[model samples]
Target: MLFNSAESQTVNIYLDDSSTPAYSVAGCGRQNDNRGTVVLTSGKTGTVLVGVCSGENACALMSQAIDISPPSDNSCVGVVASSTAGGDTNSAYVILTWKATS
Candidate 1:
């Protein structure tokens, strides 16, 4: 994410559930644009929290949730459980018809 302010301020980035900030960057947007980024290790999943603070007075401008999911192998497409195709039956078939146009 990117942040910018008319006045000078301090930027902070916190990781996971910790109150302590993992990164603290100086200077505000009017002087220069600040960018924040984080990387998740293998086998990490579920909801994570990210927060941004702006200005010299130290006010929290934004908070966001980051969700992580396991990587896919691309073997097959997954289907939603709640969808239906008209009516259900013991067997189903898909048919295709094509006609040639002169």
Candidate 2:
């Protein structure tokens, strides 16, 4: 989402329908630095909302919702840690540490 103001502002990103912001960015402006992104990984269906405001006022200059769905079962996503024999870190096979829920 875009922050329309020229001055540095605070951008809030909310997940689902909660009143509190899940993430907040300070000192943001309308220039190339205004853009931001948040990763949604609740493992459930929900909507992402973004609110941009400036200064002491809590008003939102712009707000919108982005719908999100659960990730597909066929998708492969995880963290991998590897190490070679004799505690050697030169080479090792990559491993997927995250297990599938379903």
* Best-matching candidate per lDDT: 2
Candidate 2 lDDT at 78 equals 22
Which ranges of candidate 1 are over 4 A from the true structure?
31-47, 56-102
Model 2, span 1-90: residue lDDT tens: 333344455656576777888777666333343244445444254455555444554442322222224644333322111222234221
In the range 19-71, model 1's lDDT, one tens digit per residue, is 76655555434322424444432113222333333332434332222232453
- In order, candidate lDDTs are 0.32, 0.41
Q: Who wins the TM-score comparison?
A: 2
TM-score of every candidate relative to the true structure:
0.36, 0.42
Clashes of each: 0, 0
Candidate 1 lDDT (Cα, whole model)? 0.32
